[model samples]
Target: MISKKMADAINKHMNLELHSAHLYLSMSSCANALGLKGAATWFSVQYREEMAHFFKFYTYLIDQGENIELLAGKAVPNQYKTLLEMVEKTLVHEQLITKCINDLSEQAVKEKDHATQIFLQWFVTEQIEEENNDRDLIAKLKMVGDNGYGILMIDAEMGQRVFTPPPGTTVMI
Candidate 1:
């Protein structure tokens, strides 16, 4: 069983994942309004991935008999001077999330919750991939530069992004 404090932290992280889905959806909407279909598609795909992440923890908490609270926060601004800027911010945000996951793992270890620690190990690895993917995408965007054609090419490339969550893990709740 997870400690109350650990359960609360997990629930809060679940909310962050949900917020990420919302934020990504908002970003996708902005990209669509701006006539960047590729960018919109990219964000939309990521939005779905974020939702998966949210539910992963959501179900976990429910199984643990902890309440998952709906979190409220300030709306994120989708406004950006450039697509590169948007990608840069995404990379930075991903890094922040990786750090959060690491900190949580450390806390779980300190709390002596073996199950929680094992569960968090999955996240620790996932965060590495998440950080690498964002960083690589940002690098690709940088290579594309600021030209209209370059942006279109990047858009075309990003449009191919489709998340396929692996099968076989036992889902909680």
Candidate 2:
């Protein structure tokens, strides 16, 4: 059985994942409004991925026999000055998430919750990939600064991104 502290931590992170989905969905809308169709598609995929992550946590909590608590999340920002700005904010947000996950891992270690620690290792690896992706995108954006054609090319590439659940993720979306 999972400790109440660990369960509560997972619950809180689950809600953050939900908020992430909302944030990405909002970003997708903003991208559409900005005429960045490819970027919009990318953000839409991101939103779906976040939802999947949330469900994974939900299922884990249920399996642990913990009562889930759904809390209201603060509103997400709907407006971004530019695609670069949006992506920058995304990186910042992801960094925050990485920190949270690390904290949870630390807590699990303190509580001697081996299962939770093992579960969080996946997220630790995921955060590395996530941050690397953002950094790569940021570099690309910087390299193409104020270049319409370049931005469009990047958008097209981003459009090609499709959501694939991580291996061993059995939680159905």
Candidate 3:
């Protein structure tokens, strides 16, 4: 059985994941409004991934026989000065999420919930990749600076990104 503390934390985290998805979707809308298809595509993909993360937690809680308590949603800004600004914000947000995941891992250990600990291992590793990707995008955005050509090039490259669900995972359409 899942401990109350662990269950509460996971439930809260799941809601946060939903917030993350909303944030990303807003960013995608901003990109689309600015006619940056590539940036929009990238943010859309991130939005979908965030939704997947939410479902993962949701499923885990249900499978463990825990009641899910979804918290209230939070508002996120829908405007960005530029793609660079958007990516920078995303990196900062990702860093915050990484810290949150680490805290949850610590909680799992403190509660001696081996199952939760094992489950969180995936998220711990995922954060590393998440931060790395954000950093890489930040670097590219920095290099381009205010150059229109560079921005378009980056956008074109990002436009080719397609969402591919992880093996054995089913994503809602």
Candidate 4:
């Protein structure tokens, strides 16, 4: 069993995950509106992955015999000044999420919840990959600045990204 404090923290994190998905969905819409179909696809795939993350936390809480509380999500903006701006914002948002996960892990450790610590390890690793991807894209965007052809090339590359769930994990898209 997890401590009440830990459970509450996890629940709040779950809400944040949902909000992340919403933010990505908004980004997808903005990309589509800007006629960047490939970028739109990328953001949509991210939206799905975030939803899968939310469910992971939700299932874990349920397995711990905790009552789930549904929280209302705040509004997500569907406009961006430029593709670079959108990606930069995404990187910043991901950094915030990484911090949140770290806080959760710290709480788990303080409470002496070994199970929770183990559970959070996956997220810790995921945040690494997530930040790395954003940084890589930022580098690419910086190289492609003001070049429509370069932007299209990056968009095509992002379009090829598919939602591949971890082995033995069933993620609903």
Model 2, 130-168: lDDT tens digits are 889889999999999999999999999999999898765
**Model 4 ranges off by over 4 Å:** 167-171
Q: Number of clashing residue pairs in every model?
A: 0, 0, 0, 0
Ten-residue stretch with the least lDDT total in model 3: 164-173
Clashing pairs in model 1, backbone N/Cα/C closer than 3 A: none
Model 2 segments beyond 4 Å from truth?
168-172
Backbone clash pairs for candidate 4 read none
Q: Identify the superior model by TM-score, candidate 3 or candidate 4.
A: 4
lDDT of 2: 0.91
Assess each prediction's global lDDT (C-alpha) against the native: 0.79, 0.91, 0.89, 0.91
Better of 3 and 4 by lDDT: 4
Model 4, span 1-173: residue lDDT tens: 99899999999999999999999999999998888899999999999889989988988898899999989889998889778888999999999999999999999999999999999999999999999999999999999898999999999998998987653245576
Clashing pairs for model 2 are none
Span of 10 residues, lowest total lDDT, candidate 4: 164-173
Off by over 4 Å in 1: 166-173
TM-score (C-alpha) between model 3 and the true structure: 0.96
Q: How many backbone clashes does candidate 3 have?
A: 0
Error of model 2, residue 21, in angstroms: 0.7
Q: 1-173, model 1: which lDDT tens digit per residue?
A: 98999998888888887777777888888778777888888889888877778777877778788887887865887777776777777778777778878888888999899888987787788788877877887888788787788888888888888867633234421
